[model samples]
Structure formats: C-alpha cells, structure tokens
Target: MTAVFAAPAGPTASRRDTSPSAVPRAREFRHTTDRDEAIDVITEVYVPHNLVLPTCAVDMTLAWTPLRHLVLGYLSYGAESYLIAPKLETFYHVNLTIRGRTGSQRGAEEVETGNDVGLVFLPSEPATVHWSEDCMQLAMKIDKDGLEAELARLLNRQVTVPLRFDLALELKKPKVSSFVRALQHLRSELDEPDGIVASPLGVAQLEDTVITSLLLGQPSNYYDELHSSAGSALPRTIAPVVDLMESEPDNPRSLGAYASVAGLSVRALQDTFRRTLEVTPMEYLRGVQFDRVRADLLASDPETTTVTQVMHRWGFTHAGRFSTNYRKRFKELPSETLRCH
Candidate 1:
C-alpha cells in the first residue's frame, strides 16, 4: 500500500507551502532499487542507518512532509527487513505501525509495535527495527532542542536532562489515545490543499499541539515535575527584593545579601522564596540573569561578540549549566540567538 499525496513530485524537494507556513509541501516518492540509494534518500530525510538486505526483493516507499522542526512521514519497506541505526543523537523518533507489524530492539529491550502499541526512540540509544513484509508505519522525526524547549516552557524551568520515554506507548490509555488522534488529525490535514496546514500560524500552533501532547501524554523523565503544581504567587513584601534583582540582573549576590535587603534570616528568606516562588533565591536570580543574557545575545553581533564573553559578563561562569539553562529559558542555544543577531 502507498500513501502518496496529491501534490508536486520531487526527490527530497517539494513545492514550498504557499502560505509561508511552517509545513513545507509534501515530498512523496518511491525510490531507487539500489539499497545504497534507498539509504541515501532516507538519510537525507532522517539520519544515517545501516539497511540490512532482506531475504526477498526490496521495494521502498516514503511519503514525507516536514513542519519546521518535525517531520511526519509514512514509510514502507516493500519486503520483510531489518535496519540497524546508531544513536539518533540530537532528536527523537516515534513509529506507529498502521498496517502489519514492526519490532524494535534497543539494548536488551525488545518490543513489537502495532495498532495497540507504538514506539518512541530517544536520542541516546542505538536501535534496530524489524519490519514485516506488509508493514507500513507513520514515523515522526522531532528535533531534540525544539522538543526540549517546549518541555522547558511547560516546566517553568530548564530541562536538566534529555527526556526519557518508555519505549512502548500503550495506545489503550486515554492520554495516549488522544495523542494518537492528534497525530492522525495532522496526517489527514496534510492531504487537504487548503487545510489549517496551509495557514502559517495554524501550522506552527498545530506543531506545538502535537509536541505538547507528546510531552504531556506520553510519560517521560519530567512527567512528574510537569504534573506537580508550583508554589503560590509572590507576596507583596518581597516585591522590592525582586525589583532589585530585576534592575541589576547581572549583579551576583549571595543569599545573605538578598536576605539582608529583605531583612530576613538566610534560612527564613530561603524558605519564603521557595514557598512563594517554588525556587531557591539563587535559582530565581539565575532566571533573571539568563533573561539578560538573552537580551545581550540578541543585541550583539556574532562576528564581534562571543557567547562566552557575554555569559561571563553576566556572571554565568559555569559553561555547561549556562548552556542548559539558556536553552531551557528561551528554547534555543545562546549561540543560536547570537547568529540571528
């Protein structure tokens, strides 16, 4: 079975989506018989992988559509086959077998996907997939930073680690069912020439919808953190201290300095900040500092300035944590912002 879109033909290039939407026009094709060509084509759309020759003849078809940082595609290897792929490294992959069946192996873990089950492959793991002769899968490729940015937005804090999702998505669960429907809806809309997908804002919002659904519905390392509520709003008494921090975000101050200004004991100030803001005083301070860093990155020219110079000027001396917090706060790297400036 084939899933060809009623659109222009191309190898990897398709007509640009008419409305300047995040979704580009669909790229649909049945590729070369040479295994190497098949590999090259898939690699162009996705990442590199080793395609093990099948016992029978090879017939591969891929109908792909890219929406900004995510790609939604239907893939079929016209024969029973196996593919060994290295660690996806910088992104995530999800596969829903709509027809026949598929099996995935990662480390000692092995799982089969079908109508009632789906698979999510995280970035850190190497994987192998076994596709049945008649298998057809709707595979999703999501950029890691973009997905993590959404996660950071939801958590109201930076993502400290790569998201970890259990390999199998239990389709029977209500949340999972809803998420699958979201994917199916987007897939259907892709075929509509003037659907919501044709609207620039509509496509971006839909992309956010799918990303947020996956982050929330499909459980991950941050699942519990997402569900937990934050502390109550800040009290008026602490307004002046917050104002001081905002006025001088680049200024590095100890907890005692903050406490002295607030006229509270160090421990009392710490407890008050946590009870009101759900963060330590220093964490809140870091958030303020990060905002300033973003402002400076946006204001400076990349050719004349460096992320390190800007970061250190704002007292963000710890390189690793600065990068993580930067991405979490703004959803892109400091360097990414610098380049755009």
Candidate 2:
C-alpha cells in the first residue's frame, strides 16, 4: 500500500567504523562497550536502544566496500539493540542475516530474518528493527537512481509510479535462492585478498547483479507484468521492425522514424511491438543496442579499447546506469567480457 520511490536526501547510514585502526584498507569499524558510538557508526538517522550494556560490553564490527552506486557491508554486534528510523528517505536496504536473528517492522507488516531469510526496507517507510546480541548481517544499500533505472529497463517503460516490494523475501524460491548464493559468493570474494571484486570491472558487474537479483527475486507490484506473456503473443506481422532492430541497432533513429520505416502508423507500430514481442518498440531497440555493445566488448582489446569509448559509441549516456543494465542482461562486466576475449 505504501510507495517505494523517494527523493534523494543526505546520506542515511554512517560508513565510519568505531575502531578506526582495525581495518584501514577496507572500510571497517570496531568498537567495544559504547552504544552511542555504535549508533553513530551504524547510521545517523536511527534511535538506538540498550544504551546501558545489558550484560556484557558492546562488541561490534562493521566493514563495507564502496562501489559506484552501491555499498555492501558486513555488520555484527554482541548485544541486543533496537533501532528505530522514522523514515528511510535516501536509499533502499536489503538485509540478509548471516547469523542470529533480526526482527523488523514496517507499516502493518512484520518479518523476522535469520540465516536463510532476507528483509527489505524502502525509503519512504518507517522501520523498527531488533537485532539479537549474536546477530550478524550483510547489508546492501542500492542507490535510488540506479535501482529505478534498472526497474525501467526491466519493464521497458518510464517508471511513473513507485515500485513497491513485499517486506519479506521468500529465499527458498529458486530465483531468490540463486540470488542469495550469488550474494554470498560476492561477499566471499570481497573478503579475500586480491579478490576480483576489488577491480572496477568486478564492482560494476556485482552492483548490477545484486540490484537485478533483488528486483526479480522479490515480489513487487510489477512482478506479474514482468513475467506475463500477455503482450508477447501478438501477431507476427511486425517481423520487419524486429529485423531493423537487429540490423541497424545504432541508426540513431527515433521511435517515430522506426515506425515510418516499418510502414505503420506510430500508434500501430507501438501496438504491434507490444502485442508481438511483449515489449515496447524502443525496448527492443535498446536491447539490440545492448547486444551490439556486448559483441563489441567481446571483440575489443582491453588495453586499447576502454569501456567509456565503447559505451559512448553505443549512446550509453550514464556510465553507472549503463553498467547496471549491461550486467543485468549479460551477467558480467563489459571489461570482463573484453578480458576474456
């Protein structure tokens, strides 16, 4: 019932670690026996409970990796704590419990997450989370613009409405299972010395992969439309347009121009595409362009051909967004593709 889209605000979570010297190379913070310090290091917006240690001193660990449009973090604290945020107005966070348990409430929905469960929080909603003393969580913060762009690409349309999601994720489902596995694998890579995730290519690929997985794996308002075959069964009379999309993907022609080439009224062409391919005419065009970009990346010499040059050639205006969509479709970074070839 609540909307998910939110305007950008100042940073919501604190990236600073409590013990600044423990892990200097990677963003890590460790602190003991200080609740205020913990809350300050966790996020600036939340109200923290259990200021006085219930039994033992506060033991906490926070480590994160910064990417172009996302942040991945591992967090753990040794005492029960309650965090309440009036509103999450900056980004979306997906929390995967690695150990112990977390109980979260948003609106009328409540969910408890453990090792196999995942929880989602949207920016426009208020949330209350209770973490057990032994809880360790992997937190993923996805940039608002980056995620909305991904949703737009997946739906092949302008996102005029907020993309709302179910509060709890069914991690047992096949798609969600695969997503968790990938997340674990990425986390492992990042923790390793000289891991691939340390490279620009790996970061780009993983950022997109995590966002796409969350979008597809979780139940959302647009889920049915994304998986439905309602429009893909259209008449086959529009094959000519498909051919043009494949043949001249970078023709720099507008949708209207493509309709003219197809010898159909603009509205008719749009309808034809929806009915036949289950995607808008422009969606197909963009797919073709993505395919061409992948092909060029595969054929390119990594040393001589940079990702920017190739992306610019294909009319990909924003590097962060382009990488997200590319990784969504290809499951690998453009640079990785080039490296393999």
- What Cα-based lDDT does every candidate model obtain? 0.75, 0.69
**How does candidate 1 fare on TM-score?**
0.70
Q: Tell me the number of clashing residue pairs for each predicted model.
A: 0, 3
In terms of TM-score, which candidate is strongest? 1
Span of ten consecutive residues with least summed lDDT in model 1: 11-20
Residue-level error in angstroms, candidate 1, position 127: 1.0
What is the alpha-carbon lDDT of model 1 when measured against the actual structure?
Answer: 0.75
Show pairs that collide, candidate 1: none
Candidate 2 on 143-210: residue-level lDDT in tens?
66578777766764435456788898777888777677677666667667588875889877877887
TM-score of each: 0.70, 0.62
